[model samples]
Target: MTLPYGRDDDSAAYHYINAALRGRDAEAWRLLAADSHVEQTDRVLRAMLDRIAVARTHRTAERATARARAAAGEITQAEYQRDAAEDATKASKTAHFETLLREHHRQIAQAARRLRGDDVRDELTDLVLALGAAVDAHRSAVLAAGYEPTPADEALWARLGELDVPDTDEGRTSVEDLVRRHAERQDDLGRVLAGIILDVAGAATSVPRSALLTEWKKTVAPTLAPEQKTEFAAKGKGSLATERLRKTMGHLERKGLVKRSPDGQRLDLLDRAGLADVADGRE
Candidate 1:
């Protein structure tokens, strides 16, 4: 229908089409260009179908690597299990995509052979129509597999801007460090508690759970702009923030910046300066 896209569009379709046009499959252009039906069928429609397949393939490879790493004990079994479930969902979606994808491939190959003047069975319209229904589903599956965000991550990311956290340069470098803890440990509450715990500790060498929580309820909770204190503060017996703080503190200790007492009564900041950098989202 039209020439392959230039460098401006980074869409997988454009890139795939361009690659086919300029590379080994250049001959495909002539075959597709021969008939209006062929050209239209193999253009954007083909690109969409192929892009979904490619995306699903890349996701499969990434999950394979994660599986290998989990087997070697490079990541926790719990983390692995969570990821495995997500991957299974992706794989299931991919299986559905593959069914439609293979059908389209069969149809296109038949079209190509027919273009070569060979008698080949084909059903372009029916196959294309079926693909429309599956397109959104395929996109959702690929996107979820690509990013791998949990519900906590999505909420925290939204709240980060709402809370105006890291209040430093509005850039990825700082925010990524804030979430990642300088590539040390990352979890559900890990994204937020770094700053809250730091603010609670102030210049104290040691902080107990009671003192830390008291400061959180009285001091930090008041300063926050957002009204979602339920996740960030304990009201009566226990809270999400309470458990998150406990886990985040354990993460801090593993980073070698904090130490927990034998009885878990108090925690000592071992590396104050480094901890500051960690909490502030700095290198």
Candidate 2:
């Protein structure tokens, strides 16, 4: 041990002793702070444990009182039996109603499938292809007949090539008029065919991507196990099948065949007529 420093002396031994004491003092201070934190944490944990114990005791007392009341003449056994029976009846009725609702939904979906028969999509594809061929032929004939294609006619042809059908009422009317006038120049039969084509294309467009996916899920989900369905609903890694769906959607989007929701959580089909045309070899 080193002696304490003299009042006037600045010795090396004094400095060395002071430094050594500082190192030990810092270690002691750290240990004291850690102890203080541990004590505070222990107190908080004890308080929480006490609250839990009190709650458990209160619940136990309540159950004991209820049992005593039932044992006495206050709550009769017949009343208890009646209450239990009523609960059971309500549960049974609720289950039966749920079964009926599921059946109703299944029947409705089946009816919708029958209405949109297996060949409906194929027939729509043929119609789109035929319409596109007629339009292209008419455009060529305009040049052959010594009439330059007007700006409107040129624009309409461009829109057709891009499969950019307008969804609004005014735009639909304009396209109908454009097709009617252009087709009539070829023959009366051409006008009738154009109208039928428009009707088919409109019907096809009415079936949104959500409706298609819902029908697909209804058809396929029953075949999948519970785990498979959960995997399908999950995002990111570990589900190759789910990832494939995402990839296919991405590919369609790149080809301008589909559009995504604002949040990118949903996808919607656009320009079904254009898709049909492409499927039928018009692309």
Candidate 3:
């Protein structure tokens, strides 16, 4: 029989399911089941059934008593349904974690097989450490900005924890691919930030770094949080809003967004239209 979840391949179903389970929103669950793939639906249901079977096997006497009560209408159908749903959620988490564990083991084994010597192992270790450091830096920035991670973000971090560098050609190739992907994402973010800087540049030929920080806090910060303020004023290095903006402006300057004055004060905006276009999501 066709399962309800197999109805569509849209990612919305996954989000709906996460929201439904976390928030206990029955309507969201119903909507997700109605629109998602039948196969996906069956997987979850089967998982639930498998869990129940294991429980029954362990508690045969209790199961018998419960069955008798259920048959005699001592347990309402609504109550049974709720219990089953909870069992299914337990199964779902078990399966999710099991998959991640299996994948991690598989990757570790493959990496070891590919790099069969101490020298290879060391090289792989260095590469993996570099990748992990980059990811950690980004995570720190995200946290410093007071942003909360979603479930997907946490899952990604979990997967990254499993990364290993193998000495084989395939392993090196994978590392190279990851590096390229990281660069691309950084470039994209830089472009977006440059656009925002340009929008604030305005009629002034040059903007001071301090002014940029003030304008940014006033403009962009509100869109994210209600009582929006940057935590750039701490004690250490790069610990002020102006310092953060200065670093950002340096990146933009390299990207041709602005030019540094000869006296090393204020930035002269160049290619204003290009920055505005990126800001407006036009090009």
Candidate 4:
């Protein structure tokens, strides 16, 4: 079977070339360096470009000649039309290949630059007084962006608390600490959610959705209290506790205390310590 060549083949070749360079393959690296004589790779590129230019000029002339011959009755119109159609097909294929090459050229340039890591540096001075202007700018940007932490984002941030690595304020209130604390500051229900999620954690990263709902009914159903059940009887059929659980989990997710598993049927507990802090009470 004849294997077709297309974008997949081109992409594989591009990746292979860049990976070879980044992996320090000596021969692949030579493309960037040249001997004192002639730049070998540059010459090869220029030669290919020159050939393409010549071919383009030839193609224009060839089409014009075919049209002229057909008009002068030197060749039959049907024959000329068939040849023209074939030429058009070839031209389209060539055009697509050229476009792919141009894209490869751009991405390869970027990949090469990143591979070199041209100007990395260590700390220039003792930044004991502050994190320096650049670090300060980044922190300010994070603040300015008005980031609203979602459950996934919060989960990641909460997990970072394990590091307890503070960047600002000199070893106090690591960003992760602030995130865990945010859980406490929200509402009474959030602490309640934290306790429930903590109870669900085990060898598994998460528990099924049904597991959480069942647990919710046991923990917070108004029927548990005589007065509570009577008050909610006319409230409607929707489970207020379940709605609260959804909102509470949403809050927990942002706190990074828990996350929904990719299947979304289970909720994963991310930062156990953060959840512990919440469940112990700050409400």
What are the lDDT figures for the candidates, one per model?
Answer: 0.54, 0.45, 0.53, 0.56
Q: Which scores higher on lDDT, 2 or 4?
A: 4
The 10 consecutive residues of candidate 3 with the worst lDDT sum are 226-235
TM-scores of the candidates are 0.28, 0.21, 0.31, 0.31
Residues 136-175, candidate 3, lDDT per residue (tens digit)?
6666677889999878767656555455445334544344
Please report the candidate that would top lDDT against the real structure.
Answer: 4
> Which runs of model 1 end up more than 4 angstroms from their true locations?
1-192, 196-202, 217-237
lDDT of 3: 0.53
lDDT of 4 by residue, 1-283 (tens): 2212222354444454446434655555444332321123223323344455568779989999999999999999999999999999988977775554434333333333234432121121123212332333344565579976566655544444444444334555443454444434455677766777767766666777777888887877743433233222213324556665776778788767889877768888788888878888752
* RMSD of each predicted structure: 24.2, 28.2, 22.1, 23.3
Listed per model in order, the count of residue pairs whose N, CA or C atoms clash below 3 Å is 0, 0, 7, 4
Which digits, one per residue and each the tens of the lDDT, describe model 1 over residues 61-157? 9888998999999998899999889888978876775455444444454454457543321143224323432443344575678977667656644
lDDT, model 3, position 205: 65
List candidate 4 segments past 4 Å from native.
1-186, 223-237
For model 2, residues 37-156, the per-residue Cα lDDT tens digits are 322222222333344445545655765665577789688878656655775576576556434433332333233333445235435544664576577767878978989899987985
Regions more than 4 Å wrong, model 3: 1-192, 218-235, 240-244
Model 3 lDDT at residue 115: 41
So what's the TM-score on candidate 3?
0.31
lDDT of 1 at 232: 23
Query: How does model 2 score by TM-score?
Result: 0.21
